[model samples]
Target: MSPAFRLGGLELQRFARARLTRAALVAVVLIPLLYSGLYLWSFWNPQGNIGNIPVALVVLDDGDLGRELADNLIDRQIFAWKETDPADAEKGVQEGTYYGSLTIPADFTANLKSPSKDGPPQPAYLQVHVDQGKSYLFETIAKAVFAEVQATVGKSAISDYLDRIFVSFGKLHDSTLKAARGADQLADGAGDARSGAGRLQDGLGTARQGTAKLSDGLRTAGTGASTLAQGLGSAKKGADDLLSGAYKLHRGAGTLTQGLVTAKDGTSKLAAGAVKLDQGAAKLAAGNAEAFQQVDRFRPVINQLADQAVPFLRSHTGDIRQLAEFVNVAASFLADCLADLPARIQADRVKADKAYKALKTYLDTHPDLDPQLRTLLEAAEKAAKRLAELADWLDALVGEHLADLKQLERDALGVARLARQLANLAPRLAGLIDQARDKFNELDNGLAKLADGAAKLHQGTGEAVKGATKLDAGMTKLVDGASKLDTGLGALVAGANKLDIGLGKLTGGANKLNAGLGQLGQGAGSLDSG
Candidate 1:
């Protein structure tokens, strides 16, 4: 250290003794300081001077997108933006009046819009026209600035397109939610429909059973009606026979009445002869004892004839009384038949009508019934209508003849009383010939009235036979119709079951659709949020 210190002090003394050396040393130090300071000052804050650089802006676009970009660049003041035409901008750049020219083409907005359309995408450009011969540094700076402008325009266009896409996603999310709600309602409705279809199937099954039973009952009723018709026919024949017998009895009673009147006249003549004979007997009492004995012998023979006649008249009276009683019974039966037949027929008619209505309702509701079934239902309805008409006819017949039937009953009772009076007088006919004649005349009148009543009863019975036959036929048709209804109901129930199954499947599908739509809505909501 001591030797270095000594050498440095000797150099300093030599420097102080020479003016040229001192001046050269000072100049060397100042030259370095000046160069360093000048270089530092020139580079300091170069970005602040960028506003002094001239840049030409040429906007030839037909839309506002290009103008918007130009306005943004001007407001930023990244460079001294000069608004000019395409020709002027080009001339300014070549003459170094502008560091560079930024040109927005006529198709700039069109190209930006193209990206949002449904065709091939196009790229939007910000054209940079720079002159390297004017100044390399300026050209470089202009290119860099134009590159930033391109980024700014690209970001603006991209951001606008992205914003529109996000808005569309938001709308889609709302629409999807509405669709999902609708699908849920549809699913619920399908489920309810499926349940209703099941209930319908059950109800159809019940109807089928009821119809089957009804068919069986109708068949049984048809058979019973046929039997009843046969009985009515036989009753009608009996009534006709009774009418013929009553006519014969009326003629016989008239003949008997005339004979009794002649007998009564002879009895009166005999009584007068007896009176004259009594006067002659007083005169010849003493001398004619032999004549008396002859009279006594003829009296016994007359008495024997009276005895025989009395017994015969009594037997005939008993036969006539029995015939009158039979007539009374027939008349009473006819009155009862007329009184009750109409109500019974009406009740049956009502039943038939009800059955027809039920079947018709089912047929109308189920239009898709089998052809054969429909035909059967139509036949049943016709049969029911015919039955009702037959009932009306029978009821009217009985009602029209009701008074006649009651009169016949009264006439039959009168004939029975006449026969009873004749029977009481038969034992005393010889003593009471006049009274017996009167009774015979009354019996003849009663018999004639009974014969007229018999004729009416016979006619009414014939009508009953015809009505019974029609009822039998109508019941047979009803039975057939009921069978057809049962079959149709079976088919309907089967179809209902199928419908229920189909509705179940539809419900499942609707539920799945609702669930999928819910997921889609959720995804759309997420996209919109992003």
Candidate 2:
């Protein structure tokens, strides 16, 4: 026997003596056996559902959007929902009755349309709270499942919108087709009406009779027209004579006008030139006279100005720098004198007063008639009083020094600062000098290269300028040639006009023959009428 089985058998035997122990052992074995049997029964005859999983569903919203969404979840058969208040669902999750709770806020619909970055919409946020210590993994699965459901719902909403838009688009298409057919029908009806109108116009006998009367009038008109044609023929002959004369006169008049315009342009240019020459001569004369006058007048005035300026510059010359230097030196001396004096004087006065009090106390305390001691005591008293007086004098000196020292210290510091400034400026000046040296080197190199490059550029530019000059001359020649061509074309047009006038005479003769034929016909008709 295996050790494990033997051990288990011993454990079973140990408790076999007591009836209750024996029954419990049997129950332990039989419980598994009963469970196996029940499991087999379940396998053979399966139930589609488990007991309603204690799933809490909470909708914080009262709106139709939340209601519809929650109902969809129920319809999907994901779970048997334990409809509960939001707070109670949390409690149930703690109690282990519910696997998890789903909460929807009041603005769930609005959030579906316009959601925050972290929540809802594509990511499909649902507040799913579970007792993580017990059912955290299940809650995670539920979140994933719900996420898929949300995507499906979003797609469904889109499909609904597409369906509605498609339906509307179909109706619009039909309406448009109907309208187009109606317009076609209207066009056909207009064609039919047009055909009817043509027949009506043709069948009107009164209108035809009126047209026949117009034809009779036209026949009468033909007699008068023949006479008019003869008169027009004579007029055309006269016009041709007049036009031929005008052609000759117009050619002479155009030449005269061209000469006149040229003369006027030349006269205008000559007048402008004369005016320019007169103005130049007047200006030259005035300029020379003014120059001479200015030279004579300015000499004395300049000398006087120099004399006056020399005295003025000399007058203030020493005062500015000398006074500033003197003041600066004096200020430095005063500052050195007053450095520690004010603090010393005040302290000394205080000490002297203290000394006086001490000496008086000693004198009052001792009444011994030792003259040396008494004299020594009196001397100390006088010395203390004198020190006090000295202190006052020192204090007065301190006040004077304080005033002078301020200006003096300022001047000394300014001088010292100037020295330091000069020290600071030395390195900057050196840097500037270095920069200048570099710039000079660059300038030399650049100028040498520039001179070489400029030589080449200048040669190229000269060649280009020469080419341009040639092109300009060629353009001028082309313009002159074009002007000559225009003149030739004008002459050709005049010759062509002469031919047209000759042809017009022939046409007039033909017109005369046609008029005579018309007259003969008219006379025949008149004879018939008689």
Candidate 3:
């Protein structure tokens, strides 16, 4: 410490004596201080230096999209913006009047607005012209800032395009939901139609079976009527023979009475003639009694038919009528639905086609779209076209089948009417048979009285002749009643024949209804799947 202090004092005394050395040391110290002070003064407020970094902003876009990008760069305040045309900006950058220039192209908006899915998107670039001869800090800062601005602008444009596309997608989703709801409604309607058709088919099946039974019963009744008519004809002929025999007997009685007064020798011949006439009357009475018994046998058959027919009508007719009414109502509803289906389908087809066409136009205009997005759009367009075709086909199918449903409804009403007629006919036939039985019993009693009177002719031959006259009148009345019965049976047979034909038509209509329902089910399924 002592040696170092002695050296420092000797050096200071030497430096103080020498003016050139002292001047040189003072100059050295002052030069460093002046240099450091000048640097500190120049760089003290670095933020204020931004105004000195002059940069040219050249906007060449035709629209606001480019102008917006230029404005954003200017507002960042990283550089001083110089108002310049494209040519002036290029010249300023090269001549060192501007550190750098950013020029936006004329087609910037058009390029930035386009979105593509098949390949890389077409990019709109911000042209950066930097003066390489300018200060390193100015050139580097301008480049870095412009690069960031370009990236930000590009991102903003892409975000805007993506937002617009997503809006269109949202609208498409809403339309798809509407279409789906329509399909669900159609499916519900079809399901209801299928259920109604199934019920109608079952009702028709029962009616068809009932009609077949009725036909068989009518045929049996026709056969029985024919048999009864033949028996009545035979009885009428027998009555004519009896009446003729009775007239002959009356003449014989007169002859016998006249002979009793004229000659006693003619008494044996008259008595023999009276006895023979009485024996013939007895034979006639026995034949008439057998014919009456045969006619009476039809009464139980008619009663049984009435019993069967009446209850069948009462139990089944109400149900049949109700089923027919239900079928008619269902058919009317189906007709209404089908009537509008073609028009609705046509409208749907038009909408689908319009949407598909729009998508196709967008795809045509945007060739450089992303591949995945392009594929999705293409698929959507194709699906829309297919839906249009399916809707058209469904429309045509409804138009073709509506008539069959109407016919089915008409046939159901006809069956209901026939059932009512059959109910009325049953009671009327039963009454007619009862009347015939009563008439035959009266004829049998008249024949018995004639036989009794003929046996007592020996006591009163004139009374026997009077009874024969009354018996002939009764035979005439019986023949007339039998002819009326034949007429009624012929009318019944004709009515049955008409009913058979109507039932056949009804069966055909039921089959058509089933077929039409099947077609409707298929159309509903197609709509749902699409």
TM-score of each: 0.23, 0.22, 0.22
**Model 1 over residues 63-157: C-alpha lDDT tens digits?**
88888888878877878999999779855754558866777766567656743221223334455655544332443474457555755555664
Per-residue lDDT over 1-530 for candidate 2, one digit per residue giving the tens place of the 0 to 100 score: 99999986785565555464455445544544554454455345222442345678888764566677677777765667778896588557655677656665454454344322221121113455544333324333454445535544554543232211100000001233334455556545555543344344355455556555555555666666656656665665665455445434444444444444455455555555555555555555555545545454554555565556555544554554455566556655655655666787899899998999899888988888499989988998999989989998888877977877667667776775554444444434444544555555555555555555555555555555555555555555554554454455445434544443333333333444455555655655553443
Give the distance in Å from residue 256's predicted Cα in candidate 3 to where it truly belongs: 99
Superposed model 3: Cα runs more than 4 Å off: 1-45, 49-52, 74-79, 132-136, 147-530
The per-model lDDT (C-alpha) reads 0.56, 0.54, 0.55
- Per-residue lDDT tens digits for candidate 3, residues 1-530, read 69999987786686667664466455544554554454455345644576668888888787778777667667676678876896687557545688666666565676556443322233444555554333334334554554557455555644464322200000001223334455555545554543344344346556556655655555555555555545554554554345335433433433343333344334434555656676676666566566556655665675566667555655565565656566556655565665566578778878987988899999999999999999999999899888878877776776687576456545555554555554455445445545655665676666666655544553364455455545545544544444343344333333332332233223323333444445554554443343
**Which candidate ranks first by TM-score, i.e. highest?**
1
Clashing residue pairs for model 3: 116-368, 116-369, 116-370, 117-369, 117-370, 117-371, 118-369, 118-370, 118-371
Give residue 70's lDDT in candidate 3 (0 to 100): 69
Which runs in model 1 stand beyond 4 Å of their true positions? Answer: 1-45, 115-120, 138-143, 150-158, 161-530
| Worst-scoring 10-residue span by lDDT in model 1 | 164-173
**Candidate 2 vs 3: which has more lDDT:** 3
lDDT for 169 (candidate 1): 5
Model 2 lDDT at residue 354: 94
